[model samples]
Target: MQGISMSNTMQRRQFSVLACVFQSIFVALFAIFGEFHNHEEDKHNRVHANYPMFQDIHTMINDAGRSLVVHCFGAYFGLAAAKVCHRQNTMVVDDDESSGHSSELFAMLAKAACTTATFMLSSLADHLGRFNMAHIQSSSLAGGIAIGAFANVILYPHHAIVVGAAAALISVVGHPKILEKRLSIQDTCGAHSLHGLPSLLAGFLSALFVLLYEPSEYGPNFVEQYSAIYPQWKGSGQPGAHRDLRTQSFFQLAGLGLTFLTAIFGGLFCGWVMNWSLLNQVQPKPSYEDASYYLNAEFSLFGNIDNSGHGLGSSNTSIHKCGRIDYRPLDIEAALRAVKRAGIGPDAIF
Candidate 1:
């Protein structure tokens, strides 16, 4: 999604923003939410952090296992982005004969390993030796985000590592600078780099894996093992009725394409709504500047406030003492010269 300029009066419309959020949530819950298979409904009975049964939930609570909270919230944000276009059953699957304790263990370990790999690579990509705390924190979770597409079906931990590394590479290379310039759109938060691109990569990876799936490798009960992917096998009571890999792969790709389409159109519609005169108030004269909306911002930076909450102390060279507070625009050339004198590269500061 493209970033929109913030209005100077946005803070005053807080209630309206809150109401819109609630309305979206309501629509999602009531209008679009649908039935999905539970995690324990498959043959293998494999249990993971994402899908604990009722008894397991109780046990986790008694044991003070907070992992569930992290897993659920992480999965929520990752799944939320694509849930509008895909079915829950197809996205995730229950355990079957092909899966076991080893599979469950590897799945959890894969997520951790992938997350760590992505975090390290992303940090390095941002700065060779120094870590940007914000990018590191956000990029660390890209593995878990990408792995959700085939967490259960991934047979090996090394494959998960590869996927995570690829996600990190895509995110770092496709940073907002490249995307914004190429697309001619502002992306203030780097959503496309952090979330959108990685998820799209995962979708394509899922289709590739589906095409590569081998029934013989899954053993005699492959139908039961992959029933979620080929739902026709759920109760067909047949061995090879609906085992078409190409067809499944096509559907997977189709679902992914549809998801991007919906997100683009839906985002555009919302942006249009937000631009309505009644919704958007006074536009921020200087885009992306907090000073446009923040009162006494210049004063807060260099002086103490008086009882009336105004700056009382003397102003600095960077600020002008007008009838009210007036901030001098930043001196980019002077700042660059200072940075050079300090032996710090301009790229580091930027």
Candidate 2:
């Protein structure tokens, strides 16, 4: 990730936008072994002695990161080349020179930074099992999108840049509570933030940008574009001014409302599809077997549940609830000592 950012920054004209896209892609691919990590008791996983498959998978994950960096680097570089070099007016003929200013860069960079931090917090939330972090990230993204869009369309570069920066700062400071033991890449990835929220901001800003920057042509197209969001309204490209203040307000609100509505539903549907695809591969938690002598019915009272079971108990390791029985409980210090004296013991309880 760092490699891509550095290389892309040198090659890409507007590094900020490329940064945002890369951030999203990383979250999407994190699932390749990022399904489990972060915890109250075991945020750091223990090393396995001879797990060749685990090592192989981990190596593959590292490789993906390097490849992602390279891919995004090339993409950003290409876009920059096209925008500055390939375009017609590459020199003196500047139409509103500040229009192609640094504000766009700042806005995109801020969004990327905030979103990246949100992804990390998302991982923590995944371990803890709370939706609050995700909700906050989504809401922040939505608000930023709206603000950026409005700024882009209604305000100048300086003002737009300032407003965008403030919004992004507010978003990055956010963190989550009520954590679960582990988090999956799917849940942690803040798609709602990067896409729907920003897209919303971009949409309104685009319209507003059109209106403020190109009023004569913008008036007609903005109305059509804004209205097309509704079923009963087929935008008449034959353009007309929004005469009534009430009509203008109604349309703006309608566009924003529909945008949010679609976003939530679309996100849920996508998550469901992905979840279904991985469902069959999911394994249930293991349970201890009853073969141990202590766990046998004959010594149920004296030995406790799994004390003297004949065979090894179930190998299931996952604990869905907050606190489950630990295979190696600290409270069993006395028993553990006795087992050491007897020269017999099993691994710690999970």
Candidate 3:
């Protein structure tokens, strides 16, 4: 069982990496398509005319891929953090069986619907001023995460659309307030809304879906569609087994619970590790800053300068460029005295 679990973990990681690669490819193709589609409009459009297709490509890639990929990584870690309880009679569900036209429809429609809804819901942030652009941009993708577990199970296209829109609205509007006011936790990246809460919601929805599934929805191949639930109705020459709905629901809830526990404890432990003195010594002074992480940092022209012809030079060392300051070493001192004489006071320098 341990080996089996390890195998599953490796497989899931590989699958996630593959999905990210595909998302990048899709972003490139769609960006080019959008660029061509707007070629004529670009010539006449003054607004964002300078924004080229490369920017659009990155926007599409980040908007579409980041939230989804993050949700997947969080969910995987959450599940791995806890032990899952399964009924003895429960059947194994093959992950590959879920690929079909329904899956495609779910992906495309959910993305479109979520994108539209997020735009509308983000206005709430402007009014409340509780969050910033990170929340607005990333939290909107919660719709995709909310429908993740049951994406294929949604039979009607309209239902998927509704789910996506509703999820986006809830995430963008609720996440910041809850994090700031209720939890007293400031999620700098809005990960709680973009990945965690939406995923939990998706798991609950998936459980509801299992309870509400009907044979009439999928027709003759319905049993095969959910062979993991009804083991006894195996199609073709496959061995038959059976699982009751009640047990299925219990297992689903158990999985969700385990994931929650795992995520909480795992996160706490990781945070503790990050805060340790040993780790802190090696890291940059200020946390969550890009300056320390950059391989080649460029200093801005601001500050670290003096007009006295002697200052920190281009070689990062002090140099007397014009030697004018050496002749008048007290030039600045005299100026400050003059300012005081003029009644501006010492605070004038500040």
Candidate 4:
């Protein structure tokens, strides 16, 4: 992929941009995030004393970077796990099975194709002009991640492309906005589409692949090529010791179930811990940006700013009265409702 990119004049520019962006980001990240000497002991310590603003920018960058990192590594990890465990329970007859360079090349191709598909899917966000491009791009990689678990078993380049394209299509149709509007579920990060769905898809695909796999096509040593991870199945074995397709499929499904349960229960436990008073920071408001959270926002003239030079005060009364007209932008019906709720006469509001 690197060679192909460098060989193309048009792609070289993109490579240059990508290199610059990553280099700048990492340098900034090291300058910013590397400052935390200790977490529990030095709670009051500043992360980057030299660059106070670096922390702020770091937060924004992290917000974006987290999505990409999650998608990329998520696929790689899933694929690696699948490859290692592809023949987890199978006992193969003695034969040296090797993917050679094909395994590595397949992973590389999947990554490139998946990323390209994601970017293409994100372009639709511009067409709709509603969804966040980051969310769309991240979610679009669902197909690649799903395919990762069975990438080596996938056999052909065109098949991998189809899986990626299909996943991207699914992402677009099942994006957060669509789910929120249709199902009343507000998935903030589109994790279901990006990681959850893809992982599930991969599991199912792996099971199907195992069921349909023909050892005869690859030769007498074919069993060696698609064997399991367990040490018992590491080498040549009697036919009776080897597990069948049905068992392999069952294990694959079981693994997916285990993953699902772990995520669900783990998330629940983490949520409970995070909401605990000792661990909880201030509860975040809807649509409240990092600037607002960090108290870096400029005070709106219509909003309340106390004499202490603070940005926006947490005064509902002031917000209702002064900021309503400018910040909230009340319609006539809403204005009337507010008047009635406040027990103020229409004349007084006018």
Best by TM-score: 1
TM-score-based ranking:
1, 3, 4, 2
Candidate 2 vs 3: which has more lDDT = 3
Candidate 2 lDDT by residue in tens digits, 58-161: 22111111111122222222322222222222222322322233654554455544444333333323423222333333534543453533431332334444
Whole-model alpha-carbon lDDT for candidate 2: 0.35
lDDT of 3 by residue, 1-350 (tens): 97776666555455335634564565556445532121232233232212222232122111122222346446434333221211122222212222356655555555543364564455434533222344445765777777766665665555565667667766776655454344444344456667776776776666677677664455444555445333333242354433455555555555566556655666556656655667544322223223234321222223423444333222333222121221112234434444544465566557
Name every residue pair that clashes in candidate 1.
Answer: 44-96
TM-score quality measure for candidate 2: 0.28
Mark the regions of model 3 whose C-alpha exceeds 4 Å error after superposition: 1-114, 128-132, 177-186, 228-240, 282-285, 295-350
Q: Candidate 4: which stretches are off by over 4 Å? A: 1-136, 178-186, 228-241, 292-350
- Report the candidate with higher TM-score, 1 versus 4: 1
- Report the CA-based lDDT of candidate 3 relative to the real structure: 0.47
Give RMSD to native, each candidate.
21.1, 25.1, 22.5, 22.1
What is the Å distance of residue 81 in model 1 from its true position? 14
Q: What is the TM-score of each candidate against the true structure?
A: 0.50, 0.28, 0.50, 0.46
lDDT of 4 by residue, 239-341 (tens): 4444555665666565555545544554545555655678554433322323223332334433342344232332232232222232332234533444454
The model with the greater TM-score, 2 or 3, is: 3
Task: Count clashing residue pairs per candidate.
Answer: 1, 37, 3, 5
